[model samples]
Target chain A: MLHLVLFLVFGAICVAGAINLLVQSHPISSALSLVVVMASLAVEYLLLGAEFVAAVQVIVYAGAVMVLFVFVIMLLNAGVEERTKGSRVALILGIPGVLAGGLLVAWVLIERTGTATVGLGALPGFPKTIGNLLFHDFLLPFEVTSVLVLIAIMGAVVLASRPEPKNPEKES
Target chain B: MLSLPIFLVASVVKIVLVIFILLTAVAYTVWLERKVVGHMQNRWGPSRVGPFGLLQPLADGVKFLLKEDLTPPHVYRPLFIAAPMIAVICALTSISVIPFGTAIPVAGHIIPLQITDLNIGLLVILGVTSIGVYGVALAGWSSNSKYSLLGGLRASAQMVSYEICLGLSLVGVLIVSGSFSLQQIVESQRGYFWGFIPKWNIFYGCQFVAFFIYLMAAYAETNRIPFDLPEAETELVAGYHTEYSAMKFAMFFMAEYANMITVACLATILFLGGGNGPLFGPPLLRLILPTFYFVAKVFVFLFTYIWVRGTLPRFRYDQLMAFGWKFLFPLAIANLVVTALVVAYRS
Candidate 1:
């Protein structure tokens, strides 16, 4: 009963935060709302017994990922993006666009997910079990993902490391 | 879970106790740091407050509380308020998983010396502390001053860099202990290998390299001396909290000390065989002594923190980044590989 209550509360917060993430005008506000969304999701993960996933979700997604976003926003001196008036044609199409988009998403979700309810504490995400699963059964996929990351790093370095122009003063 | 009310009662009680102890410890840590650094600088620090300035933290608290809390016109109001709360909350939340000692029978109930036990206890700490970076970052950005901006930038960057080293350094300990649960780690460290030498991770698993890296990373993570370029007085004038005053300023310091304590606790549990000591007495004494040993080890770390603050010079910004990325990162990786190989061979 208590778990159900916690799940509902955190679940509501997560949804509300996601909506806030979309609605906030300032980039910082959006970033903070996303962090809230991630955190509440982490709690939901914990209530589901996926403790390892919950921690990783917070550490990697909310902490590292969102911090970088905030850092870049600050570095770039981003304020609230300026609003532009939409054309009259878009105004006429806007209500239909929203309704159609919402219908499509709801349809896809309904088509994919079964009516089966996920039982609480059904899957305990103990670190030992996760380690075993990752290294033993999913080793190749994991190693491939790591290699992909390394390649991405190399690509970033190559892109960033352009030679200076002959006249540095002119470049400045 | 137990009967909902019982679980609530126990958890609430544990939370209150831990928070009380943690805040009190943070208070004394300020006193300890002042006295130690004062003596280092050839001064008698805070003797006016109470016996040896024992009540200095209390006096300081009163002063901060009584002072007028100010908000500059240029500063962002909501974020400025939220930042310190985030910092203090994240710092305190990690203590939920830190076990002080073995279980004891209290009022016919077997109570573990922790708020709650999670299988991913260590990971939980890492996750929670990782969130603390926001408090620093937001505090700086919201302050709407150049000094605060630069300080916040340096601080967030430094924290992000060292956090990798911090996490990597602990992987070696994780391998040796084969558990993320703090209680299990302590249990694994209970026995001695050579009858005299304790089977702590440092000695038995040869985790001294990881330990060193962890300590260095922790210093940066907490923005202490040598790693505290964010708050270099000569440079940023006080870093992220420069614009803050009164209790707001005190919150930042409180967060710092809390982080220090958390790191010290982790160091004890991971490297120093937390709460494990020579046991020659009765079971009751045995149970009580480990908590004492645990606290004593944490104190030593806190003392060393102050000692190093007095000794070392702050690293230049570029130097700090280079050291973390070029030096510590590679060292941590190397240590992890070697430890993995050794563990594999032994098994």
Candidate 2:
């Protein structure tokens, strides 16, 4: 009973934060709202008993990623976003498309799960369990994914580097 | 097993006690730092308030409360107010999971010294520490000052970079202990080698390299001397808290000391075999001695902090970043890999 109530409260907060992220005009405010969204999502993961996932969600996403987002926003000293007239193509297609996608997902979830309630902390909540699952059950896929991430990071570094000077000695 | 009502009440009581003790410790740490740093520089610090400045924190608290609270006209109001609260809150929150001593039996219930023992306690501390970056970042950005902005930017970057080293360093300990719970990690460190030296992670687990890495990374995380570029007085003019005045400023000060204490406590728990010491007296003393040992270890850690502050000059911004990323990061990773290999072999 307590878990359900807490879940609903945090779910409401998560959705509210997501909406606030979109609605806030100031870039910093929007970024902070996004952080709130990330934090609440971690709480939701905790409710589902993926404790390690929940902690990692907070540590990696809300903590590191959102911090970088806030850092960039601060460095750039971004101001309140100016409202612009709606782009015709986006206005025409985007809203309906998003609504349809959301409805489809909700319909599928409700149809498949049939409103069945899961007990609080029902899934494997221990780090050892998760570690075993990752290492023993899904080692190949995990390694591949990590390698993929490494490649992406290398690509980013390459892209972000400045090109060599045409005449380095002359410039010096 | 404790009844739910008893557990709740005990939790509340523990929470209150811990917060009070933590705040008192934070206050005295400030006095200790001043006294230590001043004596190192051949000066008497804060002696006017009380005997050897014992009541100095009380005076400072009252002064902060009585002083004019100023909010700069040009600042962003909401975040300017919220930043210090966030900073202090995150600083205080990590202490909840730290087990200070053995369980004490009272009124037919045995209560652990810790407030709550989440299995992922170490990760929770890391998570809280990560989130704490925002308090500094937002404070600087909202201050509408160039110094504050630069300070915030440096803080966020430095903290983010060092956090990897910090997390990786602790991974060595986590591997050695095979658990994330702080209490479990300490429990694993019990017993002695050769019936003399405690089998702490630093000695028996061969985690000295990791401890060194953790120490450096922790210094950076808490923004202490040699890594305190964020609030460098010479360049940033009090850095992120320049616009804050009175109690708001005090909050940031409190937050810094609190973080220092938290880092010290964590070091004791992870590397030093927390509260594991000899006991030879009555049952009451046995129960109390562990906590005394824990506090003594933490005090030594805190004294080391002040000692280092008195000794080392601040690191250059580039040097700090380069050291964290180039030096500590790889060292921590190497330590983790080596520790994992050894643990696997032993098992």
Candidate 3:
């Protein structure tokens, strides 16, 4: 009963935070709301017994990535008065996207309606289980993920380093 | 029915006790910092309030309580209020997993000193400490002041950069210890090396490098001196908390000291043979002694923080980043590789 109450409260907070982001006028306010969403997701992960994943979510998303977003927005001088109306084209396109997303979520929920359930028992030996899975079964995907991150870093550097055309007078 | 109610009441009491201990410790840490720094600088500090200025923190608390809680004129008010609260919460939450002493048996029930002891305890501590950066970053940004924003940005970058080193350095310890559980790590370090010296992480030769890197990275992670560019008073004007006032400002101060102690305790556990001592006594005495040893080790680290604050000047912001990324990052990676090689070869 307590778990159900806590889960609902957290779920509500996450949904409210997302809505707050959408309706908020300022980019900074939206970003702060996003932090709230990320934090509650972390709490949900903790409740699901994925403590390491929960920590990673908090550290990487809330601590590092969200801060980067806020820093960039601040640097761009985004403020309350700088709010702009949504483009008509985006508004029209977003309706279909939102509808599709809702349908997909509903389908997932429907598919999992009568799954086998594990009774509450001792928590599994997480370190040994995860280590075995990561090293033996998921090694290829793990290595590929590292390669992908490396490529992303290289791509960022390339994009950032492209030189602008020098003015002839300034060059001299 | 009676047992259930009694268990509930006892758990509630334990939670309250843990919180009270943490709050009191934070209060005294401020006083300790002042007295330590004063002594280091050849001056008497806080001698007026009461008994070597022991009550100075209480006086400061009252002052903060009485002061007008001001939000900056044009800041994001909701986030501004939430930021310090988040900081204090994250700071306090990490202490819940730390086992201060062995369990005591009462009414045929054993109650642990810690509030919760998850299997992945060390990871939880790391995760909680990492999230603390948000409190500093958000506080800086929400204030809508340039100084605060700059402080926030610097702090975020500094913490994120050092966290990489901190996490990597601990990989060596985790690999050697073969577990993420803090209790297991302590249990593994029971014996001696070379027939005398304790078999701590520092005594393991290669792990010594990792230990140093961990210590340095921890110093940066906590925003202590030489890495205190985030709060560099001369340049950033109190950094992230520049625009904060009253209890909101006090929250940041409290978080800083609490983080210092947290990092210190982590260091004690990771490298110093946590709760281990040379002389072994009876079971009850042995448990109490190790707890004392752990606290004593933490005090040394805390004193070192004060000593560094007095003796060393803050690093330039660019220098700090370069040292963390260009020097410590590669150093930690190399240490990991070397430790792995040594372990493999020995086995």
Candidate 4:
């Protein structure tokens, strides 16, 4: 009963925060709302017995990644986002389209899973368990993901760097 | 066995007790800082209010409570309010997992000195405290001042950078202890090697480099002197908290000291054999001695924090970043690798 209550509360927070993220004009407010969403999702993860994943979600996503987003927004001094002037038709249809997409995904998920029940404290979330699974069962995918991340980092550095002037005094 | 309600009551009592003690400790730490720093500068420090300013924290608390609480017109009001609360709450929460001593059997109930224990206690602490970085960053950003903005940016960057080394340094301890539960780690450090030396990680397991990295990163993590560019008073005009006043400012102050205490506690648990000590006499002594040792180790670390604050000059922004990335990161990684190899070979 307690678990169910916690799940419902956090789930409500997640939905509320996500909606706020969409509605808020200021980037910092949106970013903070997204953090709230992520934190609520982390609680849901914890409720599902994925403690390590929950911790990782908070530490990496909510803490580091969202902080980066906030930093960029602050550095750029981004105010309220100006509404795009592209097409009224796209804007008018986008809301209903998004709602339909969400319903379809939920329908598909429910249909596929049938009456699958999630039991609390059943799934193991120990680091050792995760380590074993990653190393033995999903080693290739893990290694590939890591390599992809490394490449992306290198690409970013390359794309962002500028060539230094041969004659420093000439530039000055 | 106790009923569910009884267990719940016990947990609440424990939580309240810990919070009360931690808050008191944080307040005293502030008082200690002023006195120690003053004495170092060749001045009479706080000798007026109740001998060595013991009542100073009370006075400050009342003053903060009664002072004009200002929310600057230009500031982001919600975030400015939330940030310090988040910082303080996160800082206090990390202490939940620290076992002050082994379980004591009293009144037909086994009461562990810790509030609660999770299998992944250490990770929980790291997660909670990592969230604290957001508090400092948000505080600075929400203040709507150039000083606060710069301080916030520097704070976030420094915290993010040093966090890498801090986590890496703990890999050595985790590898040696072969557990993520802090209680289990402390248990693994019990007893002595060769009858004299304590079986702490620093000496027995030879993790001096890891300890050093952890210590330095911790100093940076808690935003203490030398690494406290986030609040460089002369340079940034009180940094991220420039616009904050009254209880809001007090919240940030308490949060910092609480973070320092948590770091000191972790260092003791990970490397100084946490609350593990010899008991030569009675049963009460046995129960008390462990906690005594734990407090002593933490006090020593806190003293070092203050001592360093009095001695070292603050690092320049560029210099702090360079040192954290160029020096501490690689050194921590090397120490972890060496420890891993040693542990593996021995096993």
Q: Of the candidates shown, which would achieve the greatest lDDT relative to the real structure?
A: 2
**lDDT by residue (tens digit), candidate 4, B1-72:** 667886787889889999999999999999999999999999877778897789999998999999999999
Clashes of 1: 0
TM-score of 3: 0.91
Stretch of 10 with least lDDT, candidate 1 chain B: B1-10
TM-score of 1: 0.95
Q: What's the lDDT for residue B102 in model 1? A: 82
Better of 2 and 3 by DockQ: 2
DockQ score of candidate 3?
0.57
lDDT by residue (A1-172, candidate 1, tens digit) is: 9999999999999999999987888999999999999999999999998889899999999989999999999888898977677688898898899999999988887778856556886675888788888999899999999999999999999999988799988998
How does residue B236 of candidate 3 score in lDDT?
89
State the RMSD for candidate 4.
1.9
Alpha-carbon lDDT, every model = 0.92, 0.93, 0.83, 0.90
RMSD after CA superposition, every candidate: 2.0, 1.5, 3.0, 1.9
Residues B185-269, candidate 3, lDDT per residue (tens digit)? 7777778987899988878868889988998898898888989988889988999999999999999988988888888888888
- Candidate ranking under TM-score, highest first, comes to 2, 4, 1, 3
The model with the greatest DockQ is: 2
What tens digits encode model 3's per-residue C-alpha lDDT throughout A64-114?
788778778866777675556869988999899999999998888778864
How high a TM-score does candidate 4 get? 0.96
Docking class of 1: high
TM-score of chain A of each: 0.82, 0.90, 0.79, 0.87
Segments in model 1 whose C-alpha atoms lie over 4 Å from true places:
A87-113, A167-172, B1-6
